[model samples]
Target: MAKVKGEIVINSERCKGCELCVPVCQQQTIAMSDKLNSKGYHYAMSINDECNGCINCALVCPDGVISVYRVKLKDAAVA
Candidate 1:
């Protein structure tokens, strides 16, 4: 089987800095930004490219401002 990678996109402006997504990320890909959004809240940001396509962050986001994508790594494909 091919290796799967996860990509996460966060709507910073809409995020409430609730920190709900931070703990759910097993890969530690999500983090709170020091910069504040228009709402004066520290929005969530992708700290690394280690996401494994897990939707835990999105599912835990109360604002529904998180998006998750999955990519199959061709190099790890099965014969």
Candidate 2:
């Protein structure tokens, strides 16, 4: 199985709640939160297990609020 390693950041204040990122995500990792932010808008959050670090969310974000990062995995010790 391929390992997915990355982080996503959504600027809730900048988000327009258009859900443009929701459908484009192939992994179905991105979703709109039920809780509202200070701007009274629902923001997008990612499910860790569902995301594959494909960077689709960032590409779909009109406000440029989304960010993606790839994590470096530690190598296993040689026995």
Model 1 regions lying over 4 Å from their true place: 76-79
What lDDT tens digits, residue by residue, belong to model 1 across residues 46-71?
A: 99978998799999899999999998
Q: Which prediction has the highest TM-score against the true structure?
A: 1
List where candidate 2 sits over 4 angstroms from the true fold. 72-79
Give the Cα error of residue 44 in candidate 2, in Å: 0.7
Error of 2 at 27 (Å): 1.3
RMSD in Å for model 2: 3.1
RMSD in Å for model 1: 2.4
TM-scores for the candidates = 0.90, 0.78
Residues 7-73, candidate 2: write the lDDT tens digits.
7788887887889999998778789989887888898888656566778889978889998876544
Q: Tell me the deviation in Å of residue 45 in model 1.
A: 0.3
